[model samples]
Target: MREDLTFTSGGVECAAWWYPAAGATTPAPCVVMAHGFSLTREDGLASYAEALQAAGAHVLVFDHRYLGDSGGAPRQRFRAGEQREDWRNAVAHVRSRDDVDAARIALWGFSFSGGHVATLLADGIDVAAALLLCPFSDGVPRVLASPPKTVAWLLPRALADMAGRHVTVPVTGQPGERAAMNLPGEADGFAATVRPDSRWRNEISPGLFATVAAFRPVARASRIGVPTWVGRCADDVSADGKAIGKLADRAPRAELHDYPGDHFAPFHGELPTRIAADQVAFLRRTILA
Candidate 1:
């Protein structure tokens, strides 16, 4: 069963869904999950959470500050540092629960937040394992891949947002558009993950460009000492697949899986189920063992 709840993170209440492990007799392992850039827990995370819960692991899926049902000002603001803090606090909250095994916590992140998992591991958050799907490990490749015109159009808006202006941009659009993710097939792939009842907005603060460009989670991969499963989309245009491979290689105990299709492929169709099966298997071998 699912329970809607709130947890304090960064001085605000972040909305979350807690799914207790099915028929667990003892304190069970827990997986703390959150979505990628500009998304909420309602977008496409419930499937994975339910799968984990069915496999006898509690799941805590939450929205970051300033988005979805979370309590915060300046809605849709995406800050990597603050989001990481939210992840840390979520872990702490789960660990404080009597129904969860404090020593057997795992972190699950997708797309942009996949990088957050790596950074959190590097910072020595006492998690047992990590599951990263289509993680944006390095931003340089993505910056270089952006179309020249899109870059030009986004630069001014990014600058304005950095200079205290509330400039906003589309999260996804047609190729050559000024949106943050505008590669071929990206818009459709992102749309496929959105539920009809989801309250997710397409707009995000333009300052996200600068944050993403400077963020390089792959650089800290070698510092992660726990078991990590890195799943990459072979044809992902949103996040660099090659860099994700390097992350797996650099991480001390990481296994890499390459799925078919683009960055958003794992969120829809039969792929997500298959991926979740693989993840649950990994969790069973590691945290839940």
Candidate 2:
């Protein structure tokens, strides 16, 4: 059964959906999940939630504070620090539930939220497992890889954001346009990830890129000791494969799997099934065992 729910985080109400496992008697294993940058809980994450539920795991998918059905000031904010804290609160809320195994609470984060998972694991949150999908782990390399002009324009906006000036900007746009992601096909690539009936938007706080440039999770991967799974898109332009490989190499318990597409590959059509199967197998052997 699927139930709509909400939890208070940082004094804000965060919307979420709880999918209980079928035929589960005692508390079943649970996986806590959230979306990527500029996306919502229902956008392309429902399929994965269903997949996990079918594999005998309860799933909790939530919208971060400033977007979707959640309540927060200044809509469409993409602050990573706030989102990380939201994650901590989400896990804590789930741990208090009686329908799921508190000791087996795992985390699943895609894209930007992937970095959040690494940060949580580094802090030694009492999670049993974690799965990061095509993670945007290192910020310096990502911002540096952008076109010279895009970087030039965003630097000033970032500065203004730091000076107490908050504004919303396109999260994805065409080349030469001012946006957080503005490569040649970035707009289309991100659009392909959104599901129908989703409440997500293409705009977010202008300061997020600067915050991303300074964030460093891959460098801190060695500190995460959970049985983690890191999935990579082989030809991804959004996230660096080398950085992903390094992240897996540094983590003592992380297992890396490579798929055959870009950043959105694992979530596209039949590919998502393959990815989900891999995750189910991982859990079956580790947390679900």
Each prediction's TM-score against the native?
A: 0.97, 0.97
- Weakest ten-residue segment in model 1 by summed lDDT: 205-214
Per TM-score, the best of the predicted structures is 1
Residues 89-195, model 1: lDDT tens digits: 99999999999999999999998899999999988889999999999899999989989888889888888888888878898898877698898998898788888
lDDT of each: 0.90, 0.87
Q: CA shift at 161, candidate 1, in angstroms?
A: 1.6
Full-model lDDT, candidate 1: 0.90
Model 2 global lDDT (CA atoms, 0 to 1): 0.87
Candidate No. with top lDDT: 1
